[model samples]
Target: MRRKARQQTKAENRPRFWGRHAVAAALDNPERRIVRMWLTREAAEFLVPPKDIPVTYAEAADLARLVPGDAPHQGAVAEVERLEDMLLADLLDQAEDGRPLLVLDQVTDPHNVGAILRSAAAFDALGIVTQDRHAPPESGALAKAASGALETVPWVRVVNLARALEEIAEAGFWRIGLTGDADTSLQEALGPKRVALVLGAEGEGMRQNTAAHCDALAKLPISGKMESLNVSNAAAIALYAARAAA
Candidate 1:
């Protein structure tokens, strides 16, 4: 219980992010409030923080102590507050036609979520939606994996995923749930102008209720030898197909 409380506190407060890309992106994002930064002289040379932000120059060895084990900090580390909460309605209002929206159903792995965010940015996605309780909070590992995409993508966390899906449908998006058992191919389900690609966790896949919320269920065209793809890989493929279709 104490460990969980500590983790919750870390997520709520200023979390230290390392690696050049993550640190540089955070420094660039005007919405990001950097509490402090510790950087090697080389890292400090490139990452210029706001005039108000404090910076401490240190050696790479000293910087290693600030982040987790073998995190590849790349000589940069920044303690930053999380970005402000974003509303799903605001995202829907700003969404453009043909820009796919990626939705995660209980995808709790920070690495996978981060990779998905990178892919979302690559494909010019509108945004990503996830259940607040089921999603991983912003952290160093996730940010490093995203490689700066975390700052570029708009992420919205909702209280209830089903209700959020309902809202997405009302906003003119055709929700397609990706599952291995689905009979329809993603290509067959890709004719919609606005698409919301819903993916679930790897093994359990989407919840019954979550799948029910989608307009259709579709699967990737992987060979039968492979049973399933990682959720992040699946999201990238779905985004590509949706973009092509659009």
Candidate 2:
């Protein structure tokens, strides 16, 4: 009974999650009940508090106290609930008429997706589309990589990617697949219309049908020096190129 009681007490102090991105993202969630947020002087400056939730100012050591031994809290800590999942259908329905979408074929790495989310959000992307079967659930490292973009970016996971592409196409999106061996370059092929940038797992690249279903397949004009850019990086550049075309 005593050991169980002690364990429960520690659980309360254990942060809901670690790293700045996770905590910052959690803070932005309307559903998150931020009882008290601790931030170092440096971290405190950048955060804009909503009118409702009260904030706390604490030292860097205070943030360290809340996380694990090796965890880098980046001088901010927020307590929040587990993630909430948004349906792909709902997101598709909500998409605006002209906004571009990004569809991940089967990319499983959370950190990469999270970083891509940051870039997508930076470029004013509509939302992220992923296959439900091959993606990671919300986790600490992913949130960190997202740099608080996890909260801002709506991640829509679908049952079937090919069909999702079909739906997106039916909705008037021009599905563009990014690949290394494609005939045209990304800059040349990006059309002035809604686009769904399809990307795949790192080494294998896009699945055959994923490549086949796209409106067009194009490559980035790298010097062919490196084998390929990371999928997330390629996706980021592709999204940027798409935005530039817009």
Candidate 3:
């Protein structure tokens, strides 16, 4: 009886994806193991699950109660198992396509990370790299912010970001760290080669050791009055620039 109770607790702790886009994307992802889904009648028509998947019809208030008090569930919610973490080497191994990869350094905010994932998917970047300890776990808030990009993009979490940067460098990617003080503009620094765009946290920016691993450092061409852009906005601009350059 104790073992069964523990199992039930573990199952409940698994991440729950909420909102229309987030739940729809999870259903679409072949790798996602959706335990169950709850949806209102209106959302049910918009997002049809596979024939084999179990679903429950619930009212908006019921869905709201299932998630965090403030979560915007958009009439749907899904209990899902976390995706397997990918190795840094596995991500680097597939670098033949010359796609730009985004690396985050201690950017702990779930919303920023999710927004970055959205931009990464938009630009068709290879994937996102984050430190295992510093990053947030997959959650409903993140999935909501990603707006379906969470399922589409592969997020790689590594033990040591600086060392991972070394591996990225070794993998033929020219790591470009974005900094406000950098002498070169992002446009001028980017070249016709595989690139890795490294961004740090909001206030402190990239750590010194992390910056040291990069091949070059550059800054966005923004107004001098502004100290720095939000991490997500910066990621979007960087991705757009990288894609445009490519």
Candidate 4:
């Protein structure tokens, strides 16, 4: 019995994915080359496809090494290839489909960006537009928080956000700037067309010039209880409002 356990250990010792959703989604992707899987005994039996994908039973602590410290891996893990990035032009061209595009200007927090990506995917957005200088990269806790949303959403990073706004305007998108202090309510100001929701950092909100470039400035109708909502929270609310109106 001990030898059998040791043999199972040997088979399971390979690198495994630790996040359930990430691993589950990765397993679904034909592009993902999952090498191995490690699951808790109960979790092992719970997964479908009969764990036929080369799995080993593992203790929870053993799975921690693969995922971040705070992650809820749910006792399942898999090793997979990194996902790919989509070109900005491709994202732009796809805008013809009529879904609104989301533009982020200098919003640097990875967690916030990740949350926003999740929101963007939920809203059926065309893609996420971010400035190359300000946005976070694909890793860190950001991608993990985004979960599978990061893989699904196209992130376009441009050198100049102000200039990019100009390009978006040229593409016939109604650029709506979201701000806390603006006088107008977001829903009343928005047009039902291909829109580009321009957002910015939390503390600073939209930069003066970034705000200036927008075709219109809109504000979320919030009670004057606090100074501001977290950028991602505001973005989620705004995206929901837009989708509801559309």
Candidate 5:
């Protein structure tokens, strides 16, 4: 119980990012505020942490102590402040014509969210949206999974996902909900130049209300043998299809 309490308290405090890519990206992003960094001697030689931030040189074993258990820190770890909250309105205003918006409904796994962010960056997506309450917060595991895409992609969290869908429709995006039960395939639903792809949680799928908000319901064309793809893999495939259609 005490260990659980300690972990929770640490999560509530400044996030510590590990791995070389994650730390390098954090150092490169002008908006990111790195509180402190711990790097092995070899890693310190390559990563030029800002002079303003305190950096400590340590052995690989000592660096391991700074992050979560068995995390592949790759000789780098940094405590950082979370990025500022982004407004859904601002994201919509700044969106480009060919870039699609990705929305999440209760997809709470940090690693999945991070991989989705990586795919979003690869596809030149406008940004990603999620309900503030249901999504995972920024963390070391997430950053490592993202492999630096976390720094490049914009993530917007809102209070009401359904209401946010309404606003997205108002912004002229054709909101398409991805579900296995949908009669239409995703390819057929790709007519609109501006698209908003909404994906639900892994097993529970999208809530009824959330599905009702979409302009169309569609599913990926996959093999019959597999019941479902991992959410992150599905997201990458969906993003690729969206890009190909454009």
Candidate 6:
């Protein structure tokens, strides 16, 4: 109980956002509760804040102090409140336009997940689904990689990925698992249907159980010399293909 309380406290206090795009997006998001903002002179000029939010002007070194060591903050940092999590059912119910959803299976790399979010936003995906226990939390590295997409895209974290996939399947989406050994190409497998592209971790790929939940497994056409592409790269390609097909 004490450990859970401490974790809740930690999550509540850890809203430090950095980087120009990340900070700018947080400021722009109407739902985001801005605690305070620290900016270098150059970054300050570009940001116009509401009267209620506090602003602090500082030097580049000072801005860097707000983030981890060696982080590229781009002279902007903001401490804001975390956005509320979206329920799987709620997201599915609200998804009337049939936008594609990206499901990540135990892909813990923050940079990769962030890049996936960026691509999802570019392709106008409905949202991203991740297992809460296995996925990375909101952090500067993730926001930096995502650019501004972290603010625009919804990330739905669930307890069980396989169960979540089942829920997704029931929501009228065709779950397409991306695996290198699959018999069909992505384009051939995806035939103008609402889709949820499920991708797993870097090397291990999707778990056997997760694959079993998928309606179909498909692969991208790549050189035989390369066994697999990076998960983020694969996701971007899949999103583009889905968009083009739609």
Off by over 4 Å in 4: 1-17, 31-38, 44-57, 78-81, 96-98
Q: On a 0 to 1 TM-score scale, where does candidate 3 land against the true structure?
A: 0.95
* Cα lDDT listed for each candidate: 0.93, 0.79, 0.92, 0.77, 0.93, 0.90
lDDT string for model 5 (1-246, tens) is: 999999778656888999999999999999899989999999988899878999999999998888888999999999998999999999999877779999999999999999999999999999999999999999999999999999989999999999999999999999999999999999999988899999999888889999999999999989999888888898899888888898
Query: What are the RMSDs of all candidates, in order?
Result: 3.2, 4.5, 1.5, 7.3, 3.6, 2.5
Worst 10 residues of 5 by lDDT: 6-15
Q: List candidate 3 stretches off by more than 4 Å.
A: none
Model 3 per-residue lDDT tens digits across residues 199-225? 999788999999999989999999979
- After superposition of all CA atoms, the RMSD between model 2 and the true structure is 4.5
- Poorest 10 consecutive residues by lDDT, candidate 1: 7-16
Q: Candidate 3: give the clashing pairs.
A: none
Pairs clashing in candidate 6? none
Prediction 6 TM-score vs. true: 0.93
How many collisions between residues are there in candidate 4? 2
What alpha-carbon RMSD in Å does predicted model 5 have with respect to the real structure? 3.6
lDDT of 5 at 99: 92
Between prediction 1 and prediction 2, which has the larger TM-score?
1
> Whose TM-score is higher: candidate 1's or candidate 4's?
1
State residue 83's C-alpha deviation in candidate 2, in Å.
Answer: 3.6
Off by over 4 Å in 5: 1-12
| Model 4 Cα lDDT, one tens digit per residue, 4-109 | 9986775554333456665665666666566667788867666653345777778988877667786678888775445555556667777753477898878888
TM-score comparison, 5 vs 6, better candidate? 5
TM-score of each: 0.95, 0.79, 0.95, 0.79, 0.95, 0.93
